[model samples]
Target chain A: MDILLEMLEKDARLTPEQIAIMTQKDEGDIKAAIDSYESRGVILGYKALVNWDKTEREYISAIIELKVTPQRDRGFEKIAEKIYNYPEVKSLYLMSGAYDFQVILEGKTLREVAQFVASKLAPIDGVISTATHFVLKKYKDNGCVFKVPEKDERINSI
Target chain B: MTDYSKKLSKTAQSISPSGIRKFFDILDDMDDVTSLTVGQPDFATPWHIREAAIDALSAGKTYYTSNAGLTPLREEISKYVKRRFSLDYGKDEIITTVGGSEAIDLAMRALIDPGDEVIIPVPSFVCYGPIARLAGGVPVYVDLDEKDGFTLTPEKLERAITPKTKLLVLPFPNNPTGSVMRLPELEKIADIIEKKDIFVLSDEIYAELTYKGRHVSIASLDGMRERTIIASGFSKAYAMTGWRLGYTLAPREISVQMLKIHQYAIMCAPTASQYAGIEALCAGDEDIEYMKAEYDRRRLYIVNCLRSAGFECYEPLGAFYVFPNISKYGLDSESFCSRLLYENKVAIVPGTAFGSCGEGFARISYAYSVKHISSAVEKLADFANKIKNERKL
Candidate 1:
């Protein structure tokens, strides 16, 4: 299952016939493997790589760290729900250590974040305090690095 | 069947979208991503400028002024331009619009026709191409090389020109890539435009934000005055983005057309904003100097940090962004930005978002607080080290 999943991840566009040829299995087996992966929710959805910087809409990003007291029964889920409700709140996660929740948000400017905190997140009952940290740089994410690979450097080289 | 949906114009539909927003959307979906993706200033609209707006509101200056903008504001802009860039224009020649953005749109609309080619140097501000298209012009994107500090040299400019070319959009103290074309560079471009009879739409929004040397307007050059339209505003210089006030300086014939467009399209810029703009132009020189000094500090810091982290960064001469060559990562800009946001929680705009030439580069804006800039650099260095280690596997 792991090998099949790995192969599919590498080439999600691979046809059943093609997979069958590579794995020396029947088309039915390849189709079944794909079906099982989708059924198990391993294969999500495909997306186009959009070049957003050229678009009309201005891209504004910030990372906000929140310190909150977990409510009874609901605890972090309730806080997370409250934070995620705003359309501007693109992502939210309960984090360990000094900060309780880390939120990733997008808006037109810094004032947008301030407004979100003032109007939406701050009023929530369990929220004790919040510290908003705007994002300044991103080097890598989701197995993609922003640097080009050199020809001389092999994968094994440190 | 009755048509229920409003039809968007083909021009509107065909508008090339901004690439900066994509990674921003992704970063928005992640938790704790540190980002230097913005292209604006970190400082607040200076106290005096804000106070001027407030004072105007308090004094019941809420009523709309002339479509060309307040007389005092236009006069101030006239003086400011002359004082700053040594460009001469009457108050009537300038029309205050909503940010330098509106100025660009107006210039294109006032001049360009359908099928007319608008030559734009690439890896520039995101608005030029789309705005050119909206004005019924075909955007002819010319990729500027990193070797020339991402500037459009005489050869590049002359080569990009065709008989169909009507307008040339020069975005300097450029965005994405922090390149500035000084007087010498401007002279080379002016010489070409003189021979070609092409109109120049110079976006000098970052005119006052230059770190080293002074900004020279193409209009200031010989024979270029009649053909050059200067687009600038108080947004970057005065940290007045929310105010949405800007102006253009052109020949009276062009200004007349631009005023007609402004009168119909926007009616007038915000009333208080015009008043604040007056204050920014007249009294905000000190504030501009202060902000530029701070930005210079952050700029140097980021450049050094990127260099130390094994990235090759062309020393940015103007603007607050540092475009670092990230080709060593073996990933494209999108993948690079996504991975950076997801794994290390550091977000920077991939250079490809600017244009095709921006591939294998990332634009990190230094228009942030020194503290944020330092911390982001630290986090980025860590991410670079991690990638270096991971490639070993």
Candidate 2:
């Protein structure tokens, strides 16, 4: 991977100028590279990894292990496309194990997610069975550790 | 009342406490101080290495190993230096000590006679002088030129060495200064040492942190192998400072003496840490690269930030600290750093903490998160602006 992309992946707040100095590249080149990455769809979007659990916002997320039959002309791609189009389906992946599709859904409450899985998801023609496991807490998200930063316990010495 | 000062060893008594001790006290009383004063890696020990130690503990390898340390670990260290550093060492030539500090001390004790002079470059690590004095050796300090990237040039080294010079302490990837000695630079210095025929105690503790071409050990040079003793450990490389594991690589004669000191003083390095050291040598190359890249980014960031904030900072190519010149404020290093700590609520070490040659400088460690360093740099920039405004008034 490009060093600039790696830097931005870890921290999107960093400016092109700062990254130029860090990677010892021209600032103009960094800007151009970032532009190319964005236009080429290599960079999907810049989003903050917020710990919403700590905020006053009400949120619930669940991973629904799905078992489904593929359409005759298409494999799991058709079903995955159908399931990903739903607003609550935050993440969708075709699995290689006991389950066919692994759908991650997020909503305001536990019932909202279960309602999506039951009414919107299970009602699909190709959908065979659905097993929903609500996420209780997040210890990590993306690459960021979901916890208060640990105080540096080391005593300063020369 | 008793006069306790007179009862202590005069050698120990004469050595002053670290100049940064005042900052420690001041910082202790403060709150929300964004400090860049750490001298070790901020990263945790890699989980695989830690897991190896845990495995050893579970397997009940609690007993002490040999004075020279576990043979497998010693062999692993041999392979590690060979592949990572191109350093060749036989198994018997390495003796694991309790951290690099003890390796340094062992080298000092094993080699120094009462009146021998040990040449050390200044504005480097703080331990060499005191340890040399304790070993009854006279510390001959040669101030490194900032223009030379705080590296000891051949001329300066030649000028400092007397007929009584027994050892020249080469501390590349130096602490506080963050100076790295590249091969050409080291080769020049190595030429002088070979001619002068003095033993070299090369402290490459920050060897893995070199950001330039590569760290060149004087031992790797032409005829200096027999004279050079490298004292290093996993503390900086693997972020295993708490493990207290370090070793010394030297010739058989010196290793024999160092082993004697190890037997008498340390017995061996910690058993579990030795196990972890083996794992680090075997599988921690990726971990080193990962942490070193993070540090390289932080190094460039801190140097650029300090330069923009109206200070003269050399782009450090090694280690985790940036020794920015703070002499422009018409204040000494200690005074400048004290004001930063008290007023800005940011703690960085005065350069004099490392050596008197560091009197006009300050060391800000980049062994921290970018956010943490940015906040401190912001406060520092504000403080510098205020100082500028007041001077104008």
Candidate 3:
């Protein structure tokens, strides 16, 4: 198992020294390894799995399914790029199953997300049609559980 | 008034209570305490393993299993031991127990005669000495050298042996110290034991968690297989400690005796857990890898933090603990731990909690979230610096 990557994946806040103890490796070695991973694009970036809903921050998220007409020699790549180029797009994936492309985006409100789909996404060349499904709530996100279950409040006895 | 002292057996009265328990009393009252004191993993049992147990329970597998535990579970254990460590034990030679604790107890009770000395390496697991004493055996403490990464030397092992020494308890991927015996180290010990008539009780509970290459079981060494009884289980590896599922593997003669004790006492390990154990052994390899990778990260972080705290920390290879020498601060293990707990609100186990040899050290566990460990390490460093500066005046 790659210990350094695992630690960063769970909580990127871990220092090199902390990672050294976890992997039984030296701090310098861990730092160097992390640097190497970073340079090689293995570790692209680190970001918090934020629960923005907890705060009063108003935002709406949606998963827009797009059925695109493949451009000659480009396939979905050409249209995927066009749709994903928008600043509102959070994630873009060429998915199997019912949708050829699943574009996840965030906007200030439902109206904003819908406006982006109608104005920005639908009008793109080779883009056949778009179906916007507003996400009402997220129970989980990116393998992290958003809603923490009620825990036993009693003291955790040793 | 009833004489409570008389009600308990002599051995029970003689055995000292765990040193870690008193700290718990202090901890319970304190709010916002960051503890690196627990020995168990912070990770939940993986979804599939839990699902398997749930399936078993829902299917009405609540009855007691056979005396040797569920046959399928035993077979899985047998296969796992052979596959992972290359130690051969037939399904008939394995007995599923409540946990590694039960297997250790069973081994001691089945082997120890009154006055028979059990050579236990000190500054390791706390249970070995007390359990051996309860079985009416004298515990011969062999203090391991921190300079050797707490690996038991042949000379020390030879010196501890006496005519009365009946069993040698080899705790590798050890607790508290987190020392692991490499193949050559095990080979050297095997050479000594091969000549001696004493049997071996090899507790390898943390075998799978070893990051310094795969764990080399003493039983796998030449001429050591016949005399060794390996006690390990799913608790540490599979995060199944709450299930209370573990097993013991020995030669037929020893396993048969251990099974008899287990049958009479535990009847069987929880049937649902045995079902879960099979799943753990069969399909839980990926989960082990996942948790191990996570622990490896924490292990590095804790050791580095301890070293930065101005303590001499020997990097632990196998288990989740980092034992750091705190003698430089001029305070004993207990006092340092107590002060750290009371002042900094960060709790760690004093090394003396493991054994007297652990006096100059403290065992800090990394089986917590990285955030928790990071904060605790900062507090520990602050506490150490405070004490160091105070002494400078």
Candidate 4:
């Protein structure tokens, strides 16, 4: 099962016959492995990457460092529940020290972020202070980096 | 919560909320706003082009066109490419789309596989990344330098590519910044792309509206024809935004794939619009020249006005926008834009809405008439004076 999972992860595009050949297993075994993985919810889904910089729609992203006081019995989970509930919060993380949590919110403009800070998160009970940092540059994310080869690298190295 | 809400894919839910639309919504409800916030050309469709659409309707040519678009229109587009930028593409390689928007959509859908990396330069058109994601590709952004007139240097391009890089969206004749790439600039890009086996989505929608030397296509360079998809439309040139006609020229295999997706999603671009497009290609030269001249006039007027008013205005060499640096006002782009709209009744899009690099600037469109341009500039100048006085700058 581990070998099967490894092969599938390496190349999702590999055909069953190809996977079987690579794994030294029967095609039936490869097919069953894929089916079981799907049934067990291991291979969730596929997605596309969009170059928003070139498109017509606008994109704004910000990481909001949230300072919160944990409730007695509910602890930080209760505060996290409120922060993550908003649809604008793309990602939320419970952290250690300094900041209690970090929430990534995406909106159309700075005003929208300001509004969210004032109206939504700040007003929530037990929520302390929040500092928002807009992402200035995204050098790498989701296993993709935007870097072309140097002229020498392009010429000499593959 | 509704059960139907669960059916939405993560991608669908992840669509970046539109910054422009959000502001526009606010401006819409406000009665006193004089808006320059829109990215579209304020010019109406040229009379000759409109006549062509009217003629098409009169002649009862209001049926669906071939999925790829009318042959004559495609042929004219092919000729337009050659005559304008020395790029050669046959009618077979062209797909007429709903708009340049759709052309971009089709290109991404056709080329991007899941997890493929697409390089996008900022601050630029906002649609590229979202559309790429919808097509199962990841968008990686490279910030273009303001010091370099927002032009994407070969150094920047090289630093932005990776092993997973599958597509690079070249949005020159850029929005917000109004930068353009010349032949020498394109050659550097061509050199890098030749070895990478990556596809290029060259969005030259504002190709005809350039104020600098003629627009050049990277695809025209050696070995680039096969690797680049040229997406353009008559929207800016013929003032045909409402017509909803744009096209993409690519290698035949890619065109075929794009057409397959386009056919499934959009049966055909508007039929009358295609005929009008043919007319636009065949006889819209005078209209193009007239509108270009008008835009040039407003461009000069606005730039001069902004500069004389103590704003650091970047002279946009292409597109119909003047992105002026408003940092001295000590207000962020969003605050500056909103306050301008509220106080002076003049609306401009915040540069921050374009990208992070767009902070400290505001995009003011000169696509309006000279009269509106003068009035808006006067109001803007007064607003700037007020801010400077209050802030003691």
Candidate 5:
């Protein structure tokens, strides 16, 4: 595994110099490698993982599963493009079972998400049905756990 | 209440309290201290292995196992030792211990007679000397040189041996020093042991964490198998310290003797832990590699950090600690550690806690995240500057 990518995935704020010392690499080489990774699209944008429940932010997120009928030649890709273009759509994945698409979306309120699902999502051609499930809590995401692990209760010992 | 002092065994009374005890109490009261004082792995037992124990509990495997252990666990342990270290031990030759502590105790009690001698390399773990004394054996400390990377050479071993020397406690990929004895080094020690009428208790708890090369067991060398009993556990290897699972592999005759002690004393290791041990030995190789790689990165990073701060640090070849030379700072190991804790809020173990020979050095554990290490090193560098400045006066 490329330790540079691994470190950046864990904490993108680490400077090239710090990564060089951690990985025992030349700082110049680290910077060059990172630059190439960024150019090659392997290095995506870095963002903070925030818990909105702990903040003053007012929003609700929902997973809207849509059953789609594939257009004769276009298949599910055309429907995926139409759903993902909306500003409220945070993430979308083509599904394997029971449903044709899984759409993770955010809206200002429960009513907003329901309205989008009912009026906007349901009216789309080749979309058979929709089910929206609200996310009540997030214990973990992207390998970053939200719960502060039980404070290391280990006593100092041999 | 019962006049315990007068009635207690003299050897037990002679053992002093740990030197690190006071600092630990103070650390508990003080918040926001980034301490590198832990001797166990920082990672939790991987979840799948824990789930196996949960399954075992659900299945009601609650009865006491055989005196040695569950047959399946012993078989797994036997297969594991053979697969990893190339030391073949049948299921009949292994005994499940409460922890490596109990296994070491078992080895000491089963082998040492009254007034027999046990050769111990100093600056190792704190348990052996006291355990030997409790078993009515004399503890002979062999001080290893820091310049030698704290390895016990053949000459050192030879000098420590005596007519009554009945046992040698060989702990390597050592805890405080992190010095691992490779095959060639083991070969030298084996040559000397081949001549002597002595037994060996090889404590290899940190065997899987050898970063430089594979760890060589003395038991694997020629003619040493019958004489060496390997004491190891799941604590260091699989991060299962809280589970209290360990085992010992010995020659058939010696194992029979050790099993008698374990059967009488412990009855058996925790039944659920034995079940978990089976899962760990069979499925935890990837966990070992993953944790070892994490330690290796922190090892390199912490060594670089300590060296850059102007401390004379020994680059450890194994284990998760960096034993740095702090004698030049005009303070003893305890003083250096306390000053660093109070002044800089970074807590590392003084080397002397391992043995008197660990004086003038401190063991900094790298079993932590890189972020934690870097933050602590930042304060340590500041503290080093303060010491250097004061010395100029």
Candidate 6:
């Protein structure tokens, strides 16, 4: 099972036959395991980690550090749910550091990202304060470089 | 008109042009051609390394320091080789050259005399044979078997050796095929080399790019260190191809001779690049790991795609290229590649460009983005189907 998950993690495009060959398991069994994993939510979904900065499309992402006032009954859960339910929120995490919550969100522009924080986020009940760190440049994200310089396309043999 | 053939050196006139250059000229004119032709890393030089070069230039550290390259750079290289590959050479034993290409040339020039035989395993890099010829040595070919993952076996080495055999070029983590020799494999080769009393030029430029386990240099084998000259560089690992910085680690006897050639033919490697190399050696381990993981991911993707498309791809353990056996399609490597280029708008290098043994195979590099590789593979599948259907008819 670990082997199947690892192979998929390395390359989601790997067919069950390829996995079977790699793990020396039956292709049908591999497929069944993958199906089970998906149904059980162990395998959520597959997505590409694209370097959008290479394209003409402008994408602005930010990691907003949030200090929230938790309700006595629900603790951080109720407020966290409200913040995460917003369309702009990409990922929400309960952090153990100085910040209580780390909310990773994205927008089309810097102003849009700022507006989401000021209008939607800051105005939420139990929201103590919000600090935003806009991604200026990404050297590497999710194990991919955004804009690697073009190397000489000539053959390097010899 | 003067017969320039008579004026030029015999060796220069005798050398054949690289087979790859022709396809490159054709590829240059074609539009929307997605290429997996070149054996270059698509990643840029990590920013910190590049920044160090920029900083050096800004500081006006432009003058050539010494013939053997800047001392600090040599020291860094010595430290790096020891740290990463577990091989030690004193600072003076290391000579930084203008890419691994120049280091190979320097070693060849230093070691080979007229009529000395140099054994080179193929289908490997193209340069080894030519460089061996340029040094007035006979380039003895030991064709690598696809069954053995293109690693040189003791039997092959023994067969290729002769009374006059002076050097054996060990090109593991190879170019066209991403074959890597593990420690046990290296030890076997080392034992044969030791018995034969020949020197080794281990080209480990792709050392940091190995996927399965860590790369083990043949020089690390006991008694082989004195007989091996390691040629590796920042180009492949740190993605600093344009920087033109590489180093050679050898015993003092060989280093002194190589240094003499380096001093005469090339005074020094570029100063700015030397500074960048220092930074790379000091803090480029993480970058190598990051890039290797990405390459490993892409390696699996490309190999799986090729296999699914009805090509037999030996799962490469290192390097970024996948040599898929295209023999099943009933076309030669060149014809298959050319047709793929012209008909399918995809460009891949013919395996014959590397050696005669590579006739029925093609080398596809996974250095491009996953999107690019996926599109190219689809086109390749289409090309394979067309050819197979045509064969059936």
List TM-scores for all candidates, in order: 0.70, 0.96, 0.91, 0.70, 0.96, 0.81
Runs with alpha carbons beyond 4 Å of true place in candidate 5: A69-74, B1-3
Relative to the real complex, the DockQ score for model 2 comes to 0.76
Candidate 1 per-residue lDDT over residues B222-302, each given as its tens digit: 999999999998888988877898999999999999999999999999999998888888888899987887677567667
CA error at residue B286 for candidate 4, angstroms: 1.5
TM-score of 2: 0.96
Candidates 4 and 6 compared: the better one by DockQ is: 6
lDDT of 6 by residue, A26-121 (tens): 889999999999999999999998777878998999999999888999999999989989989999999997989999999999999998999998
Question: Docking category for candidate 1?
Answer: incorrect
Error of 3 at A30 (Å): 8.2
On TM-score, the stronger of 2 and 4 is 2
- 3 or 6, which is superior by lDDT? 6
Give the Å shift of residue B161 in candidate 4. Answer: 0.9
Q: What lDDT does model 1 reach?
A: 0.81
Q: Write the per-residue lDDT of candidate 4 for residues B273-376, one digit (tens) a residue.
A: 99889888888888877677667756766786678778898779999888899888999999998898888899888988888888998888876655567678
Question: Distance (Å) between predicted and true CA of B285, model 4?
Answer: 1.0
Between candidates 2 and 6, which one is better according to TM-score?
2
Give DockQ per model, in order. 0.01, 0.76, 0.41, 0.00, 0.69, 0.24
Per-residue C-alpha lDDT of model 3 across residues B121-185, encoded as one tens digit per residue? 97888889889998889999999879988999999999999989999999999888988999988
Task: Give per-residue lDDT, candidate 6, residue B20.
Answer: 86
Q: CA shift at B300, candidate 1, in angstroms? A: 1.1
Candidate 1 residue-wise lDDT, A1-158, digit = tens = 56566655644565565455444477798788788878888877555433344468766677888888888998788878877988898778888889898888888777887788777887888887878777665565444444554321111000
